[model samples]
Every structure is written in C-alpha cells, then in structure tokens.
Target: MAIDITVDHAVATLTDGTQLRTPFWRIDSDRDGHHLAMLAAQHGNEVQGIEVARRFADLCAEQLVAGTVTLVPYANLLAIRHRRHSSDLGPEQPGRESQGFNMQQAWPGDPDGNDIERVVYALDAKVIAHSDRLVDMHCWNHFWAAAVLARSDNGVAVQMAEATDLPFVMWRNSPAPEADIATSSHLMYSRGGVSMAIELSGQYQMREAEVDRGLRAMANVAKVLDMIPGEPEIIDGPMLEPLAGNDVVVEAPCSGIFMQSGLEPGQRVVQGLKLGHIVRDDDLETVVVRSPACGRLWKYGRHDMKCDVRLPDQHPYASEGDMLALIVQACGPERE
Candidate 1:
C-alpha cells in the first residue's frame, strides 16, 4: 500500500517561530474504517508518549501499514521547549514561569486567548477537528511512577486500552465536578471525540526502555484501530482504579529528611505502621511517620520537608497537616 504523508502547521506561532505541526500519514487499506490520532508531550516532561508516537511513525513508515494515522509529537512545544513535563500541577522553573495553564487542561481552546489556551485553540482547529479518537500521554511529578486513565465504556477508549494492554486502567467511575472544564482529556470527550490519557514510568530523566515500551504499545494500538498491520504483544500489570474523586493529602505529622526504610508505592500497610521517619537536623531525635489508616500505599510525595516548613516550599522540616504519603485499601490482587 502506498502511504500518503503531510505536515500541516497551525495558525499559532511561538516567539521562536516554532509552529505546531501535525503529521498525517496513512496507507489506503480496503478495511480502513476508524480515523486515529496519537498525541504526545501535551505536558512536556511526559516524554514517553512522544517517544511512542515517534516509534509508531517509524513503524508505519516501514512495516505495518494501513488506515489514516495522525501523529502529533510534542503537542506542547512551548512546554517541551522549557523542558517541563506539566504546566499545571507543580512550581514553575525560574525563567519559564509564564508557561502555566496545563496544556492538557486547555481544550476547544480560545484563539484570541492566553498563550496556553491559544495554542490549544490552534491544536483544536488543526488536528482534533479531523480525528475520531486520540491518546494523550502524561506522567507524574519527579518522584512518582505511571498509570493509564480512560473514560470507561467509551468504545474507542476501551478499544484503545485493550489494544495497548498497558500497566493500569484508571476508569473514571465518577466524574469530577469540574470534569467539564478541568483538563483537555475531559474537554476532548465532551467535544464528541474519544480520548484517553496514558501515563508512563520515570520522570525528568528519560529512559529508553520506557520509551520503547510506550512506542510498542501505541503501535499495537494502531493495529487495533486497523491503522497498521500485525498484532503487537499485550503487556500486563496495570493498576486499575475507580477514578479517585479526592486528592487525599498525606501530610507530614512532623518534619524530617523522610527516611523511608525501603518503603515503596503499592505496598500494603496497617494503621500505626511506621512507614518512615523524619530526622532532626542537629542530631536530634527522629519522629516516625506512621500510617493513618489500614490501607495500601498507593502514592507518596517525591520530596521530604522539615517539620518547620510549609508545603510546596520544600523547607527541610514539617508542620502539622503536611502531606506525607497516600494509602489506598486493596481490592484484590495487584494489577499485573
């Protein structure tokens, strides 16, 4: 099959002339049905999804070939340009402070709007307007791992997850009150296009293995969409969660250099279990950080704070109500 390729540029232009480019490539196949697009680096730091799109492009350009495939590698160039993964959640870097408004959050964007929203408007016009389904990739802050989130039962999203067979499936069991305007993923769904957010492992420091895994999975997803030929192997081990409605803050009871005695995410714990300890700077006594409930450790903060400092400031000590760790009750076997 002969594949046709095109690079369409958006109306928005950065100060550096870095226009948003959408690469549309496809080979005409008799069975071609669904139109598919995979977007990566909506948040610049989540590099694996972008890597996946790169590999999918290469594979389509070489081996498995069919259907229409639009790959938007590094959708948020400004964020990627600044080398920050997410623009919404964390503190901005010293020089790139203006890159707020999480790119993923801005959807069906405002053309004559703020920088981030303007970019979204351009993307909505240039790319999203032409696609039936999308896969938006994301990652956690520096210290956390990865997971996959999808609007459950949405046909395209369900098929996409089954195709990739990723590590976890975060089903939106209950929608957030602001689900309508919270992020681009939700906005995309509201606009009649099916979309899913895939989170990959590691952060800040990119790893080739994770990239390869993400790419391979995405390529497999394309095959599921009939955009490519040949079935790709499915990977297991995904932490499936019934969409969390709350951002439970596990704060530091007292502050210290959080000495987690080999504590890791996904580990089960009981109430009063000493998960870690906060050490005093001047060779003083250490305070043990214990679990508040009998549950499993699902997530934790990457940085430790002292007892004296306020949250997000990273003061080495802690005060009351400071976040420490997040624990969740286990359902059955761990997703694997």
Candidate 2:
C-alpha cells in the first residue's frame, strides 16, 4: 500500500500577538476509507499520548492499507510550552478567575475568543470537523491504571472503547452534568461521529510500557475500523466495566502525610479494608484510611493539590477532604 503523508499546522494568534502553530500529520493511503483523528497532550503534563501519536503516525505511514489518519501530537501547544495543565494567562475574561483556560473544555471554540479558545477553534475546523472517528488521548496521574472513557448511550462510542482492548472501560454520560464542559471527544460525539477518550497511566514523563500499550490500543482501533488488516486481538483478562458515578472516593480526614498501603490497581478488597494511613503533620497522629465500599481499588494518591515537584514520590502530603483513594463497584467482568 502506498501512503502519502503531509505535515500541516493549525495556526492561531494569541492575545500577545504571537502565532501558535500546532503541527498535525495527515497520512492517506491509495484506497479511500474511514478517517481517524487521534490527538494527545491536551494537558501539557500528559506527554505519553504525544509520543503515542508520533509512533502511530510513523506506523501508519508504513503499514496502513486504507483510510486517512490525522495525528496531532500536541493538541494544546501553549499548555505544553508552559508545562502545565492549562494555558490560561490569568483569566483573560472577567468573573472567571477560577476557571483556568483548559483546551479540553473549550471545544467548538470561538475564533475571536481568548487564547485557548482561538486555538481550539482552529483545531476543530482544521482537524476534528472532518474526521469520521476521534480518539482523544490523555494521561492521568500515576495512581490509576489505563482506562477508556466512552459515552454509555452511544453505541458507536462504546464499540470504539471496546476496540481499544484496555483493561478498564468507564461508562460516562454525554454532556456530563458534573463537568458541564465540552471536551473534544464530546464535541465529536455530538456531531454524530464516534469518539472516545483513552486515559493512559502516569504523567509528567513518558514511560516505555505505557507508550507500547497506547500503540497497541491505537493499532487495535485501526484494525477494528478496517483501516488496517487483521482482526482485533483478544486478551485473556476479563475487562472491567465501571459506571461513572458508582465509585467511592475516600478522602483524607485530616491534613497529613499519606502513607499508602502499597495496594495496586485492580486489586480486590472487601468493605472497610485498610487502604492507607495519614500521619498528621501537626500532632503526629496516625489516621488510618479504609475503603468505604466492597470493590476493587481503582486509584490511590496523596491528593490533587499542587505540590512541589521536588517532593519525594512516597509519603506525599495530603490535606483534609483531599482524595486518598477511589474504590469502584466492579461489575462482573466481560470478555470482548
């Protein structure tokens, strides 16, 4: 199969009168088929997906038999430059001080809006609008395992999620009431195209294991789409399907240093199992953190609060009400 690859940029002018050029690759085969848009690095810290997109593009250029693939390694250029989750320059709009400019939340953005908005607008028009399917790649903190998020109500989205061959698939409703933001995947799904978001494990730096897993997932997606040859591979482990709202998040009872129980993701536990402990920074008291429900451990971390990068990975500090662990009510697993 002959593949034609073209590299292009989606340009957007920032408020500072600087042009932000986001590079994307369009790889097309001689035979026309479905178009797949794979994007990554919406949050600057999540660099694993960016690597995945690059490797996937290279693989497609060599082996893709049909269809067109749009690969965006860095979807949020400013955020990646800043090395942060958002690119907001201190609330360009009034009365929105708390709402930091997150490109993922600013979908179908305004051409004449703020910096992030303008960038999203350019990308939506230049990339997303023309794709038949979209895979919004993302990364979470090191606490959770890799999972795919898909709209429970959309059959196409669910099928795409299943095709990823990831261990966990979280079923979410479109237009999530809690978030109330337009993500790139949500925008694509709303436009009658199949879309799903894959959350890779770890952030800040890329891991070879995670990158390989991401490549496998993307290859599976391509195979399922008939963009490449062969049937999607079936792994042996039972796949976990968890509903979005049916999980329990255990929070810190008091501010202290969190000492985890060394439990890994996918480990089953009964209700009230000891998950971790908090060593009070003030009084030196130890508070044990226990599971609130009977289920498998989904995610566990010190807290979401911003911390110094120099802090040791183990025994990180936590504040009161900060999430220490997440226990999902694991439904019976099903094989794809």
lDDT per residue (tens digit) for residues 178-214 in model 1:
6556466666666677777777765455677667767
Where is model 1 more than 4 Å wrong at Cα?
Answer: 1-6, 13-31, 63-65, 85-100, 173-183, 230-232, 242-297, 300-336
Q: In model 2, which range of ten residues has the least summed lDDT? A: 89-98
Cα-based lDDT for every prediction: 0.62, 0.78
Candidate 2 lDDT over 1-336, as tens digits, reads 447678999999887889989999999886788889988998776889988988898888888988899999999888788776676533222112326487877898887888989999989889999898999999876777788888889877766778777767888877754554378876776667888889987777888878887888898899888888988775623456655576888889999888888886656667777888989989999999888776666777764433212234324688789788877765444211
- Give the C-alpha miss distance for residue 213 in model 1, angstroms: 3.3
Task: Give candidate 1's error at residue 2 in angstroms.
Answer: 8.2
Pairs in steric clash, model 2: none
